[model samples]
Target: MLTENVHIAVPTAFSEDESLHIQGTIDHIRSLYEQGVKSVLVSGTTGEQHSLNLQEKMELINGLEQEEELMDNMEIIFGVSSIRQKEAEELAERIRPTKLAGIMLGYPPYVRPTQEEALIYSEKIIQLSNKPAILYNNPNRTGFDLSAESIIQISKIDLVVGIKDAGSKEKVEHIKSDTHRNDLHFYAGGEEELEEKVLHGYDRLSSIAGNISPAKISQWFEKMLKQQKVTTQESEEIEAIMGQVYQGNAIVNVKKILNQQGIPMGICRSPIGNV
Candidate 1:
């Protein structure tokens, strides 16, 4: 089980020439591990997953596998989604033997498959990975919303442990009532409107800002989950952190911050930070 309440969705590092910097990426995760972070999501949106080709992703996985300390200690969840189902399936198969803790199974952006097709895609990837899965339903980005019915149906697989950006409060209520699985977690994709989302039943966080301030972010989130009040000073500090993270393109801003901190996060792939 992915037992971490918060996992930083880390960005993949690239050189100035935009080639994958495997060591740089590993170093950032290692930094997080040193800060007492329990888990991280690699190659997700922040990691420029789609921008990475299958070969590059394979190399990244190979790189992570070589880090014995991190591989043994961190609950490293890899993102597995592609416009091509075959590519996604192949990624899942490769991950099957890895020590990777789980997968964030996302929908194919711009493809917008029907509910039935999405369900089938979900089942296939989950089966192949043979690991706990967190279904990612970012309709705003993917153009395909996994409906509450579809979410409830997919949650039956047992390996499907959670859903990220699971839509409105009403939708979450509907799924919660229907799924009959009390264990199904609702993961807020980022910290935006997070308090409300938690009230709406988002029990976990796929944190972006945590890439910058792991201890502060994780502690604040844990307090919120426990219904503890955030002190005014804590709120001010978090506001400053969010300003740094969410002020610009989040991925781009994060890379710049990590770079400034001497973590070697480099930059985002072109067209993202290009502007």
Candidate 2:
């Protein structure tokens, strides 16, 4: 079971010429590990997974395998999705033998596979990877919404532990009420309207801001989860952090901050930072 209440969806670092900077990516992850982040989601939307080809994705997995300490300690959840199901399967097979803790299985964007097709895609990847899985539903980006019924059905799979950005309060409530499993986690992606999402039944977090301030974000999220009070000072601090992160392109801003701190995060793959 994936036990962490929160995990940072880290960005993939790239050099000036837009080549993958595998070491830079690992370096940032190691820094987060040092700062007490227990989990991270690599190659997710924030990591620009869709922008990377299969070869690049495989190279990242290889790079991560080299970091023995990070692999052993952190719950590193990899993101697996490709327009081509065959490629996704190949990646799943590749991850099957690694020390990776889990996978965040996202639907292929643009293609917009039907719910039945989507279910099959989800099942095949989960079975092949043989890792705990988090179903990621981002219709805004993917243009395919995994319906509440589909989510309930997928939750029956022993390998699927949670769902991220799983639609509205009604959908989440419906899935929770109907699913046989009680431990199904609803993960709120990023810090946007997080309190509302929590009230509506989002029990876990896929944190983007945590990349910059892991301890602080974790503290706030825990307090929110437990219904604990936040001091005025903490509220202001969190607001500032949120503004710094959420005001614009969060990934670009985060990379810039890390770079400014001398972490060598470099620039985001072009077109991302082009604006």
Candidate 3:
């Protein structure tokens, strides 16, 4: 069971030519580990995961496996989603033997499957991966919303631990009320409108801004979870952080900051930083 309340959704480092920088990605993860970050999600939406081919993702998993200390120390969750179900299944099988802690299972993009089809996809991947799973619902990107009823049914599976960006407040409430399990976590995708999301029952965080300041983001999110008030100075500091991150193209900003700090995060794939 994955138990971290907040996990950094770290971006995948690419070289100057936009090839996967496996070592650079690991280097960033190592830096985060040293900075007291306890958990991380790799190849997530922030990682430009869809841009990565199956072979590239497999290579990344291979690279991650070499870092025994990092894997042992951090709760590493990998994103597993592809436009093709067969690829997803193959990826799940690939992840089954690794030391990765869990998977963030996202819906197929563009080609929206019916709820029943999505359910089958979810179940098959979960069973194959044999690890804890977090259902990722990003209808804006995937063009398929995993309905609250579908989520409620999926939660019955012990391996289905949580849901990320599970739609509006009312939908979250509906799912929460319908489900009997208390361990089902609701993870806000990023820090955007997080206070409101927390107020609406989001207990966990899949944090994008944490890539730049893991400790600070974790501290802020913990306070938010507790509904504690932020002092004026704290608010100013947080506002500054948000300004730096959320101003434009968050992943691009993250890479720029990391590269400036000499972490070799490199550039995002084409069109992401084309501006």
Candidate 4:
């Protein structure tokens, strides 16, 4: 059982006027490294890819590779989600030349395409980009479930390398039983699941919780890998505090966490509001 380090899919902090130009974001990426993050995912859902225009999206991708800490140690995954297949493929192709670690594509949000349709979408993206892509199968966020059968079949294509999982125990188990290759990576999200999921052969975690309390997130990730039993010594505490902060002001709490560490932290976009 080889487990990779956790990845912080950071949410971009914007300026007051719906911009993600703050220096605090890059600074935060550095801070996350200090806390034991092995990878950084930019322009993903956590990074608010949905909010930014094409230019802004590319800028965010550019920023991650520019940071020294991120450039060297961290594996940077460009999370590209779009309503149109051609658009996602185009973005994937354009950034292939950059120092991007890989591509992570979530299911197109607006339309719930059938599994076959999704496969075609992924195939076209691969054909267009000719770069490795991570299949981001998050059903809770995407509406329809992307099946393991589809993913395993898609894995035959050289481009689809991994998946950021958001399915249930059974679904994961199904994939686990079906999937056998080491090149294909599977990362889990959500805080409560860290301990349990790691035990069950998950390779990595692309965590939102890892953002605010990365030290704790790192501890949990390592403990889950090395220690006999999982420890929630830090996880529970951070969640309790962040839970309140999240309720009142997620943006402020995220910013405070980033600023405390010296990242290019700033405000959230308009649609996101205070959080």
Cα error of candidate 4 at position 258, Å: 2.6
Model 1: residues with Cα > 4 Å off, grouped in runs: none
Q: Write the per-residue lDDT of candidate 1 for residues 1-275, one digit (tens) a residue.
A: 88999999999999999999999999999999999998999987663788999999999999999998998999999999999999999999999999999999989999899999999999999999999999998888878999999999999998999999999999999999999998999999998899999999999999999999999999999999999999999999999999999998999998899999999977777788988
Model 3 misplaced regions, further than 4 Å: none
Candidate 1 positional error at 125, Å:
0.6
With a 3 Å backbone cut-off (N, CA, C), the pairs that clash in candidate 1 are none
lDDT of 1 at 77: 95
Q: RMSD in angstroms, all models?
A: 0.8, 0.8, 0.7, 3.2
lDDT per model, in order? 0.93, 0.93, 0.94, 0.70
Model 4 TM-score, all chains together: 0.84
Over the stretch 226-246, how does candidate 3's per-residue lDDT look in tens digits? 888878888888888999899
Residue-level error in angstroms, candidate 4, position 256: 4.3
Task: Output the lDDT of residue 275, model 2.
Answer: 89
What are the models' TM-scores?
0.98, 0.99, 0.99, 0.84
How does model 3 score by TM-score? 0.99
Best candidate, lDDT-wise?
Answer: 3
